[model samples]
Every structure is written in C-alpha cells, then in structure tokens.
Target: MSLDVVVVGAGAMGAATAWQAAKLGADVTLLDRGQVCGGTSAHGVGLVTRLLWEPPDIGLVAHSLDRFRELDETAGASFDYHDTGSLLIVGPEHEDEVQKVFRTWRAQAIDVRPVSPGDVAEIPGCADLELAKAEHAFFTEADGWCVTMDAVRAMVDEARSHGANVRPNTPVDRVRDGLVRLADGDELEAEAVVVAAGVRSRQLIEDGWRPPIDAFRAQAAVLGHEGNRSGPIVHDTPNRTYWRPEGSGQVMIGDGTDLSSHEPGLEPSVDEAFAHRVAERLRDRWPAADPIHEVRSWADLEAATPDARPLVGRVPDRERVYLCTGGNGFGFMRSPALGEGLAQRIVQKGSPVPLHGCEPSRFEEGYGTGFPMQEGFALD
Candidate 1:
C-alpha cells in the first residue's frame, strides 16, 4: 500500500504537519536528516508574540499560541510554555508603524497597551532598559515564549500517536513530486510529498528547479543575568535584535543575522565579537552582562525568500509536491498554525482559499533567478 503523504524534515514544521495530517486520517511518513527537532527548530529562542504585524500573520499566530497552551496542558507533555506576554520597543522613526500595530491589536480585542519605556522595568523579570533613547513602547501580556525543542517533541509525539511514521537520521538525497530518493538509494512513493527541510528544502526540491529561497547564518547566545529571567519577550527594532527570559537567571538574545547565503557544512561557531557586542549592549539595562558569563552560544542557518514570506502549499507546476520553507525568521512562531493549515489543505479538509500573498505559485513567474535574502518580519 502506498502512503498518503511523506514529509521531509523532522523539525517543528514537519512534525506539526505530520500531526495534523495523520490526525485527519492521512497515511503519513515523516523523515528527518537527524533526530526529531534537531535542526533549526532546536536553535530558536522561541519568541511567541502577536507583536509582529508587518507580514500580517495575526490569525496564524493566535492559532499557534492556543496550540502551544493546549500542548502544555496535555498529559505527559511539557512544552515549557511561558505566558509572560511580549513588548515591542522602537525608536521615534518606527513609532508610526508601531502605533498602527497597536490600533490593529486593539481592534482585534487584544489586551495590548501603549507603555512608556520606564514601565518596561516593571515586568517581573525585566531589567532596567536603556530606553532613555527610545521613543515608543507597547506591551501585551497575552503572548509568551516556550522551549521550542520541547514543543516540537510534543508535536512529533502527538503525530506518532495519530499513526504518523517518523524516521530519524534518515537523509533524503533527492525529492521528486510524490516520490523521494533516500540517501541509501531507495525510493519511496507517496501521494503527496512535502519538503520542509528548512534552507535545504531548496536543494531537495526536484534537483534543478530553484524555489527562490536562500540561507543565512543567525547566532544566538544564552547569558546568565543577575535577576529572574521570566520577563516579557522584547523586540528592540532599532537594534535589530530580540531577547527573552530563558531559565532561572538567564536571558537569550538573538539577531547576529548574516544576510547572506551560508554554505552548507562550513558552519562557524558564534563569533566572539557577537557575544562581546551584544553583552555591551545588554549592560545598558542589566549592567552586569558579560560575555564571560555566557552559558552557551551557537549559530545555525536560517531560511529566507525574496519577498520574505514563506511558500506554503502545493508547488507551482507540480501536482504531488508541496513547500513549507523560507519563513525568514518567524517560521517557528507560526509553526503549529502553518502545519495545521498545510495538513488540512493536503488532506482536503479546509476551505480552498489560499494563503493569499503566501502561496508558492507566486514565484513561478521568476522561477529560479537568485534573489537577495529578505526577512519576512519587516515594516512597510
């Protein structure tokens, strides 16, 4: 008997897709190059927020957050979900955009509020911020952060419970529409094949056909701070960085984003310069921040598309193939929702209305010309 769907890449997106697809009664097989949740999904700081508005993904974000909370409440499942909400700080220049976002959230019945920079210190685990030079700030206690790997594992485990076959350490050398060639030279056929292998999805996508996705190196650090690390997640737009409270006395900061394609296998460790620079930046608020107190830091490749939005759904010019990559940096934020939507589409369970601007067919016009990496989370 043939499988209904074969999902490549066992990361969060892949696992979520499998979970939904299998739950809907599709025969599913999810394959991964390494262990489940081992790739880019494992390295994320897992910032969950409705604060991101540029790409206009509020519905998806809301769904993902609900799913995260649901998983946390599940039996034997610990996603380490933290419901501390989130804050977005910007300079005077970005205030207009932030104001629009605030209004939109308010209209949507979100409990967000305009806050002065000094108020940020009041958040339980937040240190005094260097917002003396900042202009606009907003906060909503509805968003939160989570242990991404744990969330991913829970999703995968749920998928397994729903009868999805998961195979780890199984690398696929090639992927064709409705079929995949394993690294061991075996070929498996399915009715639908989804390539969610992060940046590498471009390579496994039917060989010569370029899918308009690129890879870039992003580094993050885990730092030991003096106070409790349970503050609302912060997005410092001016600094192009974001941070969240990480365990008991630690914080995680990210955004050493190298906006260029990272050559595979030439992975570089986090730069000492990045640690030093971010540490000095952190001291403006925390004061005792230091690179020497770094618990762990690492770098990994992140995916991006020309338009910054991800290509989710069936690939253009192909019937049996689909795509779920190139989310810029916000893929993990919407993983659960994305997976559920894609799974429903594949299983023919939802409305036929597409993701609008996010459909994969939009790239069919250019069809492979190299494009610069663009982060999906950006203001107009």
Candidate 2:
C-alpha cells in the first residue's frame, strides 16, 4: 500500500509518530535499520519526568507524562511506569536558582515543592546520602521513570494495530524530497517523510544541509544492592550524576556530564572508567545501601541540538519532508508529545502544541556558534 507517511527510525520517537499518524487515519510505514527500539532507545536509563528547567520543555514533558498514563491504561500492560517521583539536588551554589525554579514550577501548577535535608532523608534509599550538605532540593511527586523498551513495544504494537506497517532491518540510504531510498536500492514515495533517525538523520539528508544535530557518546551502568532499595530518581547537580531504581534491589546510574561529539554508527562499548565514576557517585549518595555489584554497563550515541531542543516541523526548502530529531538525550521522555504534535502538523497542517521554538528553520538564523550541549538538564 502507498503510504501517506514514512517514518524513518523505529525508536521511541518514530514509533510514537507512526502510532499517532495511524490513529489519525494516515497510512503510516515505520522503518528501522535494526529491530524496533534496538538503537539508543534500548540503552536509555528510562528516567521519565517533567521537572525541566526550560519553560518550553515543561509543557511538552507534562503532556508526555499524561500520554504515558493513557497508553498504559489501554495497552494492557504496564510499561513499568512508576510515579516514584524525582528529586533535583543542588548545593549551596545553586540553591537560589533551585528555589526560583521551584517557585516557577509551583506557579505553573506542577506538583513540585521544596525539600530540606530531613525530607530528603525520608525518601527510600536516600537516608545515608550526603544531601544534607546541599543547600536545598526540589521534589515532585508527579515526576517518575519507566522502562523505555516496554513503552516502545506498546507503541509499536498499538501502531501496528492501527494498521501501520512496521519494517525492521530495512535501512534507508537517503531521503530526497519526499522519497525514501533504501539501502537495498528500492525507493518508496510518500506524501510526507519524517527523519527521526536520531544521530543518523544527519547522514540521510543532502550534503551541506546541516540539521543542527550532533551525536554524543553516553555511558551508563547498573548496580545491584543487597536488598530492595527503592527511591525517587535523583539528579545530583553537585556531582553531575543521576540514578534511579532498576528493579527491586538494583539501581541504574549514568554520567550526567556533557560529553564530546561522537561519530554515528560506532559500535556501542562500555567504559570502565565511566562506570567506576558512576559507582563512586552511587556509593557517596546511598551509603546505607549494601556494597554495589556492577551488573552491566553500556554506551551509545545520543543526539543533541544547539538549542537543547528537538528539530521538529518541515525541513527547509523541501516539500513534504519533515524532521523530528535532535532530542538531546531526552527523546524517550519527550517522544509522546513530539510524535503527537508532529503527526498533527503533518496531517492537519497545524498542531495544538506550540512548536515554534522547535522549528527546524530556527537554525537558519544562526542561533549560536559552538554546541550548547551543557545548556539542558544534565541527566537528559
């Protein structure tokens, strides 16, 4: 069947886009070089939350959380969607900024409140942390985490149920105009094409057409504890680290540092040094927990934009060619809203969500010279 839309990339963003388009009655085809959700999406730490410093991101993430709830209710299985809440810990230096953000969040009607050291100690697995030394912390009961692959699977299955075609291991060499040329020398024409191929999206477009996206190597590892060590997702600003519960007794930690840009298609490998650093941070933060055992570690390429936001909307000067890349490592958390918004814009020519700041053409104005990788949330 001739597709009304062809979505390149089957990660969380692409899967959600295909599902939204199909639900809106569009004949959608989602393509991926590997199995669905097997890219960076599989390597995500799965920390989903709406506690963002950026005002524009707040709405998108809030909407995404609501969508996650909706999907969980109808998808017949939990995506391990846990509303365990989240904490953003800040030392004395950042206390004022954290307080200001807390006020803003409260004013926005978000369920966020200031927390003191005593309050922090009450949260599970945080009793022995050195957070008491920090000046302040903000806690949001509505913020939480989920299993990325579980959500991806539900999205893909729901998209397929809506009659969307899902093609796995079908790599695309390039996209010209509204046509997708596969690696196998086949071409498929569509009413519209969405490049959601993460870092690889840069390679699919014409030369000299920079998408303002860069890829970075991100590393993370899991640590197993002796007993169940449940707790809110922690974003320790002082250490530039974040950790969240993996299972009943395990926790997953990742480097929140801004890493250098990396080449696309590089084989994912774990860095022992990075893992060791995360382990050190975990030990410092949760001293009460039993000696940690490294269960696993992995590294993958994550995409980022200069503005720390995604490039959504139509590609400049290209008819029916759209882009939904450059997630800045928060792709999974933002995918639901991004996908729905992009689907609406493509199908109805307008979206309910305000996507002006995320337009692809924003880069044409030359926003900044060097990459702004350090601008967004460290754990993104």
Candidate 3:
C-alpha cells in the first residue's frame, strides 16, 4: 500500500516528524538502517532549551521547548526531561560576541540574563569557579535536556498507535520513480518523502542532487557523580566544555569543539586525543567530582552547511521531495519546533517559519548552479 508519507531515518527528528504526521491523520511509515534511536539522536546530550542568542531561531527554539513540555501529557510517556537550567560562560575573547547576543536577546525580550563570575561560581559543582577570571556569562533558568532514547521511543510508539508503521534495520538504497527501493528488492511507495537521515542523508540524494553537508565526528564523556547538583548546566565557553546533571548519580560532560567531520561512509569512532582533552578540561573545571567511572562515547557525523544553518525547507528541484537534514549539531534541540513546523508546512502548503532565508534554493541561487558540497567535495 502506498503510504501518505514515508520518513527516512528513525532518529529524534524523523521519529517526531512521523509522529506528528501520523497524529494529524496521515498514513506514515518510518524506516531506519539500524535500531531505532541508535544514531546521533541517541548520542545527543539532550539539551532541550530555547535560550538562543539568534533572533530568527528564538521562536523555533521556544516552540520546541513548549512542545517538549506537552509531550508527556499528549504522548503518554515522559522523555526524562530535567529543567536544571544552563549557563554559558564567556571569555575575554568572546566578550564582544557574548554582549552582542545579550543585546539582541534583551531587545527581543527573551529570558536571558547577563551575570558575573561570582554568580556562576555559587552554583553546585562550580565551587572553584573560574568566573572571576572569565569575561561574562548568561543563564536561562528555564532550559534543560530530554532523555534522548526515551523521547524517540515515545514518539515512535505514539506514531504506531496512530497508524504509522515504523520499521528498523530497513536500509533504503535509493529513490526511483517516486518510490523508495530497498537493497533486498522491497519498495515503499508514498505520496511524499521526507529525508531526516542525519549524516547518512549525504548519500541518499538523486544522481545529480546532493546537499552541501559535511560529516563531523563528535564525542562526549559521561561522568558519574553521587549527588544531583541543583546547579544549572555548568558551561565554560572558552574551553567549549559543558557539564549537566544526568540521573541520580551521573553527569554528562561534553566539549563543543570535539568536532571533526569525515567523508561519507566513514565509520564513526571516538577520537582518543580529543576525548581525553575534553575530559581533562572537565576535570580542571570541576575538581570536586569523582573520576569518570565508565566513559561511553560514539562518533556521529553532523550535516553542516556553509552558513552553519540547516537546509530545512523543501528541495528546490523536486516538488514531491523535501529536505529536512543538515541540522549541524543542534538537531535534537531544534527538532521539537523544527519538526512540527515542517509538518505544518507540508500539510498547509507553506512554512510557518520564514522560508526566505532558509530555503534550499538559496544555495543554488547564490552558488550559480553547483551541487551543494563541503569545500566543493561531493559526499561520495
């Protein structure tokens, strides 16, 4: 049977998309190459916050956060959301940039607050705080993270109950004549196709249509702690490192700069040097915490665009095909709002968010007819 919508990849974004589409009365089917939520969606730090510095992204982030708040009541499962708050410490080098963000957020009336070193140091696990030497910091008491795997599972379950079919270990080879062809000779016919295949999206395009997505391998370390710090998400912008309380006895520490994308088909692996470097940074920041008990890590490539924003709207060349990939590293955080917005556009025939700046056509229009590439290199 031809499905109303066949979503590729069952990560957070794909799962959320399928759930929304199915919930809205469309027949949906979700396909994935491996276990559900095994991709970057599972590996994400789950920072679900709308405290964005960019004005354009503020509404979308806010929408995502709001949706997350309603998930348990609507979707029948709690995604393990924790509103422990978050902090962004600014260094001398980033003072100007930080101030600019503050000014813009304040102008827009966001709940962003500028703070001093002493203010940040008072938070738990931040006793030996470096704020006194740091430049500035920002806090959003309303921010937090969702349990990544649980969120995906809940969405999938809800979508299935709503008549959507989600299949794992079903690797899609390509799309031909408006149907998704599998390697084992199965075909999925659909009225529309939405590609939310994380980094693997780089390879699933048509013969001539490729997105300028670069795969960056990112890794994070899970530190075990005894007590949950009521302290907000502890972050040091200069070190590109952040620590957030996880469950009862653990904290998740990740370095933002531990990113280095590789070519397509490159199996994700942990960068020992980078991981160790980040661990050292974390240790230095929080000397009170015990040593990392079990360090679990994975590498996933992010679809990065030249301008650092995602190519979120419809594909320019193909009318039936839509492009929802290239979320960079913020896909999970942006998925709640972004997925719902995409669904609204697909169902209503126009974007709820402004498409003038985010359209995939902009790349072709600005680049003069070349396929989207990273440094002009093709995905294959």
Candidate 4:
C-alpha cells in the first residue's frame, strides 16, 4: 500500500510525528532502526522546563506543554506526565546569568516567579540545600518530567489504532525524494519522507545537503534515595547540573554534557569521574538525598545545530523531503509540537509559522563552519 508519509526514527520526534499524521487521516508508515523511543530521550533526565530564549522555541514548548497535558488525558497515549514544576538554583557566581534567564522568561509571560532559598528547602527531597548561601532561585510552575519509553510506546500504539503501519527494528537503507529503500530491500513510496533519526538523520541528508548538526555526548545517572519524595526538577546554574525525582526512592541526575564530537551508533560511555562529581554536588545541595549513590549510568549522543535550536519542516528545493531532527538538546520537550507542525505540512494544511525559523534551508553554504556549537541547555 502506498503510504502518505514514511517517518524514519521512531524516537519521540518520529513517534509523535507518525501518531499525529496518522491521527489526521494520513496513511503513515513509521520505521525505526531499533526500539521506538529507545533513543537519546530514553537516556535523558526527563526534565521539561520553560527556560528558553527564542520566541519560536518558547512558543513550541508552550505548545508541547499543552499537548503533553492534552495527551495525558487521552486514551492509549499517556506520557506518565508529571506537573511537579522546576526549580533553578543559581550560585552566587552565576547570579547574572540566572537573572537574565528569569527576565527572559518573564518577558515571554512564562509562569515563573522568584523563590527564596528557604523556599527551595521546602520542596520534597530538597531539605538540606545550603539555604543561606544560595544567591538566586526561581521556580517555573509549568515544568515537569516523564518516562519517554513508555510514552513513545503509548503514542505508537495510538498511531497503530489509527491505521498507521509501525515497523520497529526496520532499518531504512536509503531515502530520496518520495521513496524509501529498506535495509531488507523493501521499498515504500510516500508523499512525504520525514527523517527524525537523531544524529543519523545526517547520513540521510549528507548525500544531498550539508548537515548542520553535530553529535555530542551527554551523560546521566540514576541515584537511589532513601524515600519516594522525588519529583520536582532542580537546576543548579553554576555546576550545570540538573536532577529530579524519578521513580520510588530514586532520582535522576544530569550535567556531564560536553560539545566534544561523538559519533553515533557507537556504544556511549559515561565518565565515571563525572558521575562522582554530580553525586558529590547532590550530596552538598540536597542533604535529604545524601548517601544517594549512582544506581545506573548512561550516555547518549545528543545532536546540536549551530544556533542551538532544532531544524524542522521541508528542506528547500528538496521536494518530498522534510526533516524533524537537529533537536539541539531540546528534542523531547518539543517533540509533540514538532510532530504536529510537520504532519500538518505533510498533509498540506499548514502555514507552519512556528517552523519558519527552523527550516533546513535557512543555512547557506559553509554555514556549519563559522558557527560554534552552543551548549544544549545554556539559556543564552
């Protein structure tokens, strides 16, 4: 059967895209090289915060937060959504930066407000944060976290219910124009071919266009606490570490992010020293989580573009080829919005206003060389 859309890479971005496209009545085929949603997002800290600078980024996250809330209520697609909010703790040294971020959020009318050091201690699992020394702190009410793998599975299940053909562990050999050649020699034709395959999306685009995305590694660990009082995500600005309550008696910690080049498909390695460092910080910041040790650690190759934002929508001059990758470290939070917008474009029913700045063709020749890679969660 001819499919209206063939989505490659069934991570959050691709799964969300396929689900929405299929829901909109498009005959969709979602393909993945491995398990759906078991990509970088599965290895993430699952923190969804509203700390953004660009209007497009801020707008998309607002859309995503709304969508996450909407989907949580829908059958077969619950994201295990949490509305625990987020707390940002800035040490005295980085007070300027946090102030700027707070102002940016306020300017956008984001639901954020200042929190005193004492207030930070009140949150569960945050009792012993050297309350007197904390310089700047704020809490964004809308931020939260989720379980990615379960969420993606639920979304794909919903897509299947809508008649989309979902093929897991089906590697796509090649993509061009409107045709996709599978690794096993199967061919599928679709009106639009969307590549949301993380860093690997570069391999598909390199033959026809220069990829502006760079792959780098981000490491994180799960620490087991004594109790189940883990929920809200806390970001410490000076250390660049962020963590939140995970499952019962467990919390997730992330910070060991670097821009150093890392190839995709390679087994990712977590720096042991880095893990210890974050654990030390956790011990100092939140005494309640003290004695919390690393229960597990993981690393994922995160992609970043020159401008620290994802590239979405159709590639200029490349008819039938649309891209949904280049997450720039904000992929999971914005996946639903990206999926919705791209699906609308594929179905030919969108002006795609939010994606105008993220168009793949916006980068001209040699665009990748001059621009330095931006840190994933850096506010500016």
Highest TM-score model number: 2
In model 2, residue pairs whose N, Cα or C atoms come closer than 3 Å (at least 3 residues apart or on different chains), thus clashing, are: none
* Cα lDDT of model 4 by residue, 1-380, tens digit: 43489999988889889998998889999999888786886776766777765667777888888777776777443557888888877767767766776777887789898878768766665666665555777877688888777667777887898999998899988888888888899988888999998888877753557558778888888888665775478887666788888778887888845677776667678776877888887777767666777788888888788877787888766788889988876688888888888888778568453675778877875555334667757643
Mark the 10 consecutive residues where model 2 has the least summed lDDT.
366-375
lDDT of 3: 0.69
Worst 10 residues of 4 by lDDT: 364-373
lDDT leaderboard ranking: 2, 1, 4, 3
TM for every model, in the order presented, reads 0.93, 0.94, 0.88, 0.91
Model 3: runs farther than 4 Å from truth? Answer: 1-3, 75-78, 122-128, 225-230, 290-294, 354-356, 365-380
C-alpha displacement of 347 in model 2, angstroms?
Answer: 0.6
Model 1: colliding residue pairs: 85-143
Task: Let me know the TM-score candidate 2 reaches against the reference structure.
Answer: 0.94
Error of 3 at 197 (Å): 0.8
Between candidates 1 and 2, the TM-score winner: 2
lDDT tens per residue, model 3, 244-348: 777676777666563455775777777767556766676566665546464566667666776657666676667666667767677777776666667667766
TM-score of 1: 0.93
Candidate 1, residues 266-328, lDDT tens digits: the string is: 665677788766666676545644332678888888877888887888887778898887768
Tell me how candidate 4 scores on lDDT: 0.78
Give the alpha carbon lDDT tens digit for every residue of 200-290 in model 2. 9878986445687777777888888767867789888777777888887898887747467776767756765886777777777677675
